[model samples]
Target: MFAVTVDQVGSRSDDDRVEQAIDVVSTTAAGRLVLPPERTAGDEFQFLLDDAGTLLDVVFALARSDGWSIGIGVGDVEEPVPDSTRAARGDAFVTARAAVDRAKDVPEHLALEVAPGRRLGTADVEPLVTQTVRARQRRSREGWELADLLRAGHSRTEAAELLGVTPQAVAKRWSAADLRSDDAVHAALARLLTEADTPAGADTPA
Candidate 1:
């Protein structure tokens, strides 16, 4: 069996909600589970999965069922058989542990990438640092500032100029705001334009 963990997303502080969701996901499926948060931080969970793939499917199912978001990570096992080498156990557990910690702030539905040597790196894991930073910025206070500039038809370079900063600075800020993806930038611009078209204080949601 391999170790795995799932962490949920909350808009505010939803420690209880995260715990409840973890329990539901763990017990609903057959796995050796541990409540790390209950024992300590109240923000994470741990489990030993007989089949990692089975747990991953259940993780997604639980996220949908709870209407909450979750990030998942799995560690490598030296052997599929029980009681594998400590090195393998430590390797998988440590990497997965690190990924899980990072995922707490990442957007829902994005799985953590396993590092090289432990498990072959997945496409999902590349540039995760950039992705997570961008994800957080997209929902952050600065996200609003960047959105305003983009809606004014500013090219990224132009936006940087308008913001009185370098192009690299603009890209950094924009990427940090989670506008790195063209789809994300376009969507944010569309929302901003739509909002601007509305009268001020019209009681319409932004």
Candidate 2:
């Protein structure tokens, strides 16, 4: 199981922003949630999941809209897991809180704690985000527009149709945007994490 905690940066300073972030997180996490995300404090939220596979995707999505910190803990949850974050009890929650505290100390916005060796804050998100930033920095205004359309699941042909351009033109912008490489990197990371989460001797997807 994976326990996760998040607190919006300076959310308490602006009550309205906290409310807005809560809505954003809710909307983004709807179908992906295991235990529904819950507000633990006015500015804090918590949830638990049965796997760590999708952690990166969720964190990056939240980071896009606003500033927030996240921590994830991989371990066992006590039997009969409750739907509420407050009602859940286990090493996972304890580790999650610790990781979040560490995240608060550093500039990075995310941390992960793994069990079996007490690997707290083992995953570093900086390199992944750095590559993304580099990719964004290399883009132009037109490139961003084309990239956004592609990111929304539109193919080069579809984006070209929407922009009234040739598919070749859209594909050129897509290459310049480097979103394919970024996505490939993310997909590789997700696979690695899933394999790590799977117990030894248990079969994992190839």
- Report the number of the highest-lDDT candidate: 2
lDDT of 2 by residue, 33-147 (tens): 6676788876788876664435665666565554777776666678888778789988778878887777676556666665553322245433554345344555787787887
Residue runs of model 1 more than 4 Å from their true location after superposition: 31-40, 66-71, 77-89, 124-206
How accurate locally, in lDDT, is each candidate? 0.48, 0.67
Candidate 1, residue 162: how far the Cα is off, in Å: 58
Report the Cα lDDT for candidate 1: 0.48
After superposition on all C-alphas, the RMSD of every candidate to the true structure, in Å, is: 17.5, 3.8
Angstrom error at residue 21, model 2: 3.1
- As for candidate 2, its clashing pairs are none
lDDT of 1 at 97: 66
